[model samples]
Target: MEDFEQPVLSVRKINKQYGGGCASCRGPEARGLLKNYCPVCGTVYACRNISFEVYAGEILGVVGESGSGKSTMMECLYFDQEVSSGEAYIHSYKNGKANVFAESSQQKRYLRNHFLGKVYQNPLLSLKMNFSSIGNIAEKLIAAGNRNVKVMESRGKELLEHVNIPLYRMKEAPKNFSGGMQQRVQIAKALSNNPPLLLLDEVTTGLDLSVQASVLDLIKTIQRELKISMVIVSHDLGVIRMLADRTIVMLDGRIIEHGLTDQILEDPQHGYTQKLVQSLL
Candidate 1:
């Protein structure tokens, strides 16, 4: 399969379930009752049997309503949350390949340090409040083991320009910048190391239409110019249409539809997908 040609990232049969209440605290007769009261949402399965592949240079968009496990799945891919079962395979240009679930702690650390870049739904939270935009971008380089101050500064400026942030404002703190600019800075930070895969979690979610369009264009331009693959998670179909070659529509922790952007948009087969298309239209 084309998808098996050393995909940048692959998620296989992922089943993430939250644990239920403490049965140890309950009496023998009440043990059954404890099952109904999950300590975390009563032992719900946030994601079930989720499988997908993202090849290098492909932009795959995952769309769904709020509380549909979009963010949870992204978190898992980033290694921010441990998977309860199944696996995520990350193939790196330098590190060869490693299963996210099976890697030792040191191996996982190496993968995170060298290969992954993530942008969250809120740029403000992702960025450091104490650092300037340049500092923020430079920090990633430092974390990646680049120690030369001159090299870090040069790369930081190049990244800022690449993301369309002005050179003059590079010294300004992210908190002082507008929402759109802050998002651009976050993108710059994510691109600092030029990782093979980028996970964008609704980077344009709260922006105005005009700002949103600009951010989307920036992202598209960066993807092409950098030749990097991405997995964008959003609830907005319009956003997916603008950036994704392939779209995956998810609902209630399951993928309701997956296909070419036009196929999914113009001729949706599933009821949930149809509703999404209607909303977009």
Candidate 2:
């Protein structure tokens, strides 16, 4: 495991709420004798006091059930959603540092353009329907302001090959590829900008065991080769064990336990973590 004097990303006391009473304030129930049905308890809390750190070059896995806020917290950290409270800080080598919550629009744009990359579970959502794999990756690099189009093309080809997608397939739409291949294309797209921190949300979910293992191996190889920090959100303990240096187990939007992956897998301190491990066995 690697240690960092400063973490690449730090999240503290985050919170997110949705569908509050305001949205339902004027519903039919609020109009008459059924007023009690519009009780102000309509708000749903998606995240609360979530805190964690990702050290440079270390892979941190977050595991939890469906409604446990794993994806919400990841999205908040990545600035996909505005945090209701607390702070998310990203350490930047280029322009000092800035909190994801406190940064100005320009600063946030700088961070998104230069420092971060994300991979979603569905590759089709990430790709352009009208563009080929090479074109899609090249377009992102160009949009990020890389000057040389030929260099972008070359790099795109190299990345596709790096992810084990055939060079010939580079000209085909992502829809033409298998789920696993599409995922590989997504990985290539996320790496197109050479981001220092990568966030992966259920990257291997819904794939066969063999394909999942292969994708895991590819992710591990990329992490090792690039030495970039990674945060992976998944429910699969096997996937966490295969890729994570450390694991954090969450439930009901709170971290129940955290430690070295091997330690947690072998002897979990929290009942929830133990149950999860047992179910895997």
Candidate 3:
């Protein structure tokens, strides 16, 4: 899509690194030591100069292999992990003028609760195993400053229903549910705040093929009904092809190609991307 209107989310030159870089790996292009690691200093360059935009009500997919840093980028966007260096702006936050990465911890928490939602690949990261599925959703609502138990409960039940979780099971704990059920609960919890933007990191990674299809359908339904912008990270190009309007192909911690999903799949330019598409077929 054209950039005529302001994007819902804008991120520029995001770089996340672990450990200090040595001279041997400073200028990654010149050094080229390993995929994203510097054996010299034991530093791992997880993400490097990644940039992209997510327009209002659109899904932007980030596809890559395990070490390609797509998940790291998602973590940075949701503030689950701090960026080593970058600027990110959300249209609803400070009118898209302020850099969220530079915001205070309290401000980030505010954004997470009121402006953004994230569903982790691992339900353990976001869900309280012992809490009722509805209670998990209520926790997010409470974080967003909702104090009325009746309102929270009503909202939680609505979300669970939307995600296809039965009302009778709303009181059940996620620990007692199946993997697919737990993911559905997480999706319900993520949408509890009705945030404008959603971050999905490897959401369908570890599920049966049939279960994956169901969850993918649930995500598509949520996107259509909510019309919310999303940044979905996955190692599976097939998932990206099915869900994303626009896609970014990342390799070696950097974006190798980005364009409309169909265009990239039909005429992938990068060697890595071509292989990815081929494998998808």
lDDT by residue (1-281, candidate 3, tens digit) is 42438899999999999988878888747384688888888888889999999998899999988889988888888888999999999988898999999999999999999999999999999999999999999999988899999999999989989999999999999999999999999988988888889899999989999999999999999999888888998888889988999999999889999999999999999999999989988
Screening candidate 1 with a backbone cut-off below 3 angstroms (N, C-alpha, C), the clashing residue pairs are 20-39, 38-42
User: Model 2, residue 10: what's the lDDT?
Assistant: 81
For model 2, how does the per-residue alpha-carbon lDDT over 52-99 read when each residue is reduced to its tens digit?
888889999999998888998877776778887888777764333556
> How do the predictions measure up, each by TM-score?
0.89, 0.88, 0.97
What stretches of model 1 exceed 4 Å from their correct place? 1-4, 21-41, 93-97
Off-target runs (Cα >4 Å) in candidate 3 are 1-4, 28-32
Model 2 TM-score, 2 decimals: 0.88
Q: For model 3, state the Cα shift of residue 109 in Å.
A: 0.5
Clashing pairs in 2: none
Assess each prediction's global lDDT (C-alpha) against the native.
Answer: 0.81, 0.82, 0.91
Instruction: Output the worst ten-in-a-row residue range by lDDT, candidate 2.
Output: 28-37
Tens-digit lDDT string for candidate 1 (185-234): 98889888878888999988889999999999999998888788999999
Candidate achieving higher TM-score, 2 or 3: 3
Worst 10 residues of 3 by lDDT: 26-35
Q: Residue 17 error for model 2, in Å?
A: 1.4
Model 3 alpha-carbon miss at residue 95, Å: 0.5
